[model samples]
Target chain A: MHKTLWREIKKEKNYLLAGKPVPRLLILNAGSRNHLIRCFLKSWAEQGEIIVSDSYPLAPSLYEDCRSFIIPFYKHKNYTEAILDLCEKQKVTGVLSLIDPDLSILSELKTEFASAGILAFISEEWIVKATFDKWEMFKVFEANHIPTVKSWADLSEFLNDVKNGKAGYPIMVKPREGSGSRGLHYIESEETLISVWNNAIEPMLIQRWIEGRELGADLYFDIYSGELIEFFIKEKLKMRAGETDKSVSLRDEKAENLLKRLSRNLALYGPIDVDLFITAHDDYLISEINPRFGGGYPHAYACEADYPGLILQNMQGKHLTEQKIKWQSGHYMMKFFDMVFIDDKTRRNAGEEIKQQEEN
Target chain B: MHKTLWREIKKEKNYLLAGKPVPRLLILNAGSRNHLIRCFLKSWAEQGEIIVSDSYPLAPSLYEDCRSFIIPFYKHKNYTEAILDLCEKQKVTGVLSLIDPDLSILSELKTEFASAGILAFISEEWIVKATFDKWEMFKVFEANHIPTVKSWADLSEFLNDVKNGKAGYPIMVKPREGSGSRGLHYIESEETLISVWNNAIEPMLIQRWIEGRELGADLYFDIYSGELIEFFIKEKLKMRAGETDKSVSLRDEKAENLLKRLSRNLALYGPIDVDLFITAHDDYLISEINPRFGGGYPHAYACEADYPGLILQNMQGKHLTEQKIKWQSGHYMMKFFDMVFIDDKTRRNAGEEIKQQEEN
Candidate 1:
């Protein structure tokens, strides 16, 4: 859906306010073509120019009406240098890294970007690491008395917990650091659990299953003011490819209070997406956090919860007002497929254009 | 999705006002089981009790936590008598019909229900007939100068138009009185048009194909004041079986002004569903209208457009204000499939329960 909807927003030109010229924004690894990326393109375009980068020259991001650059992957030795070069060339005032692997790297290089007078919209290094590692997040939740699904790193410990009547069967065996339901298995019997554990990946966790409705909370914190500016909650109605395919925006006091508390405790700098479950007894249990915009961010954006505006304001050295978070409830979002056609000749021409830029 | 969400609405009960007791409402042909029905069930239940009826005892309507009844089809000899008897027994104060075929029948029987002190929330007979008959509706649109796709009832006339460069190829051959795309076809050549015309049902029309973004408008007229109280427009991004599968709510002054003119011209009482197409040249064309709740009603409801509340107020002898029409824009709705399961034994038991009630 993020494949260059330049025509859709042409009528929106008249609504843009003529403020001080804002600098370009750099969005890293922006070629996956998701709904959240499309929303941000629409929201941020009204404020300032946007620059997107991916590893492939023929990526969808290249087709958008913005500055595009092909850079090395996050694991590459020159990846950080390539991004800094792109930011300098484009005069980027703010840098946002979307994918998971780059969040920690961007957090570590925040100081470098800051030295060049470019604001990095990322959390602190410790917050990024704690949120990405499930075991570390579990410890943080326990310390804050926030209920989370119990887990065991060893099969013997899980069995002992089962024997002690503290946990039950139908538990999940999942990778310690994974997204999109990779290496996830549910086991109900001892024989199945043993077989799965034997073939399981290293650094896996066996977690107790919470049999209830799943919820996602999209929140944001002002890096300068340390105030929670955005808090939107939605109930996940359906899942596909380990992402929320359908969801409904709603108001829940208990869930809202929990997210506010989490914001105060974590002090996350930029956008935050948290996954949790509401048990049969009406208990809110924190499960995980994604430091960037999650798959369900479009639902929040459609409700007029403007996170992109906040990011632009922060880049301009302004605090986001609470008035920006006023949003509607009862909105149900159902996701579907859309397409963009590019002839082979056009793609090859685009590739040649990028090749000339690279050579220059 | 609305299979007795008792826990989700537990917090809403305190907001109910203890005024005069609201009587039970009867919804006819309630087995389609869409999001609008679920919303109405939730909305009306807060004001008073709800009773649903369908031809099948095992319909999805029976599974909802409300009074249920099995009735004969609309064409049955005793259909009117059956509804009247049910209203008398249940002390029903309001009745709403959801299907296309029953709207005219309900409109015809409006006077009978009025005599019995039961309000039938349907438009007048002339309005119902005009909306259902495409040829008549087209004439009405032409009289008002609201653009509509050119159509022809005579094959020779259509061929002459095409030959004279008045129209182009790829026209639509559809049944003159069809719904849900039952006999819809796109003909690009002379031979294909001939073949489709041979197989089409009698009294068919050749409609000009519009290549543009389609929009659905969910509207309501206050029965008490004869005023257009609610209007919500959505750009239909996807459709299934003539139903809006994915849509985004927005405001368009061109479309809104057209709808307002239509409301004043038609003086439509109760709820209305209008379909239009925004042409490639940025022209709005009136397509069709259904005098009952259309498939996209849930999107308006989710935006807090409160059509059900307006209907309830009308039934309660109160006038709806302009404040009820205020709603949020940019709300997106994505519809998907959900299931409500009932075992063989439970279904049989429900059937038996209905049979006992019928015998009584």
Candidate 2:
């Protein structure tokens, strides 16, 4: 790790000597199991050190040759100013966010970074809001003539529409700002819809049930040239708690074309993980658009596509060349396993239970 | 101005009394145009005190209400720490950039702000670069499937394409990173293209010229909802060096829809000034996208649309319910006039020439 850091520092000094600016990328909310952030930090650490706050204690993977600082998490008024001071002190050239809630904060911080000639990746506030909201994403899809499952803002409105044949039974109901699938449910009858509506919030959307299995595509685009450089599509073979547990990559030309058309219509520039349902009629309807890095992003990394590297290049005002995905062509599974230290008594009880079961 | 300041302060106090968070915006720059800075200070002084460096003389408009300090512009290593100290002292809640180069600096400052839960507007470094480069903008358009005039990276490449019938004459040439069309030229043939390219050190792009009168639209969108709240479209009646000399607001449904679509596709939020060319064949192609406040933004203000106010609302995380725009429908122009304070001899010579012309 020390050797890597020394080599990176030497490379940066060489670039500086050649009059080429080397951008220092700062990662906020650094501790995550997501492969995108890990790969991003690893690649970036090879170029320059990343400054991370002390809040992230578990994931030491990102600490390899990178500097870490203990700082308060987002909730204080001084946070933005503190970051500006850090960038100035360290000569940080860029900033990146690996989580969702931090997107808005990143957007706001971009302006401050700009005054000092540093770079940050944040969209306009409204665009960030629209892309974050499920209902708003649908509105943009509708406006751009992109096909999507029929959706409504309120459950009552959805019920009325379904009763009047505007929507159908077996509709999907979920919260407007929920993560995972904790509150999501499939309703097959009027009674279920009424029950769900009574408990749900005022601004929830109801959409038609997509018939086929779930699939996802991770795509990156050049904001200036509107060129699609890398794409990875995977079919979810299994899932646990709304997170992909196992998936298989498929080379479907139709899906690729659909993604192209959707991105073209939306003029998206950054990383986009789109969820689609291939229906009974062989049509694809977008279920959701995650504009930032998604949970199963490691799957893309496993396929040999470094999304964070591409993003870093874009931030430095460099054009991206075509990068081919060396996809691992087989099923991959991720299991969430936990370990706890057990007392001797508990261990004996567990052994006894196992012996009893074996005897039976 | 004093009266307005007092009233705003009283209003802000009332808001604070009612348990509402008083919105505070921070500006980071090395001081430009005293009049413009004073305008912002006057407005802010009504609600909150202005903060600036003490090295520069305080503008008369902000003398009493503004707070000035001593700080280095970009030389400090611990700039983020210094900003945090300032924020702690002033209790700031938001930030804004008063200059172009400051955008990147602001972006880097977002990380600290995110940790503190404050809001900002500058885009991240990647987004800023994509929007700032004209050639990259075209690439993004193509990647997103938005139709734009044909463009090439260099004059030689453009000429070769033209020879092969891949391109045509009467092209538009400009520096990829130029502002206000300083090095922009309308090339009638290869001769002019070569001449313009040879004279400029900046990288250039040659685009097929869309022959028509220029039009610009300044629009703001609800980032969360992807809804257009305020829009202003106008025809450029006169221009001096790339700055609009005169313009008149016009209502065209087609143009309005096109702008809205473009904004959604780009996931654009905040202030966007789009330059367009409506071809003789009635096709509209994007000339450029400025992801910041334009010189003629005040025209939107005159039309009863408070764009800056919308930005403030988004910063405060407040939803916009009703925003109306009122057009006066008459010709309006902003002429760029120059003034020179010179010695007696030069002034006398210029005065005589003006007097002679007037007499004749």
Clashes of 2: 57
Alpha-carbon runs more than 4 Å astray in model 1: A1-360, B1-21, B163-165, B321-324
A157-244: candidate 2 lDDT, tens digit per residue: 7767767878788888887776677578898988987788778764566778788877888888764455677888878866644666
What tens digits encode model 1's per-residue C-alpha lDDT throughout B1-360?
334446224423432347443655788887645455567667776666667788765456566676567777778898878878887766788888888888888889988888987888888788788787677778778887878888887888988988999978889988878877878888899899988887765778889889999999988887766678888998887775566766777688899888888755675777789898999989899899898887668778877777877777787788875554565555666553333334445556656654665676
DockQ of each: 0.02, 0.00
- Error of model 2, residue B37, in angstroms: 65
- Location of the lowest summed lDDT over 10 successive residues in candidate 1 chain A: A7-16
Q: Considering only chain B, report the TM-score of each candidate against the true chain B.
A: 0.89, 0.75
True contacts kept of 2: 0.00
Candidate 2 deviant stretches above 4 angstroms: A1-15, A41-45, A54-62, A264-267, A321-360, B1-360
Q: TM-scores of all models? A: 0.50, 0.44
Ten-residue stretch with the least lDDT total in model 2 chain B: B335-344
List pairs with backbone clashes in candidate 1. A334-B334
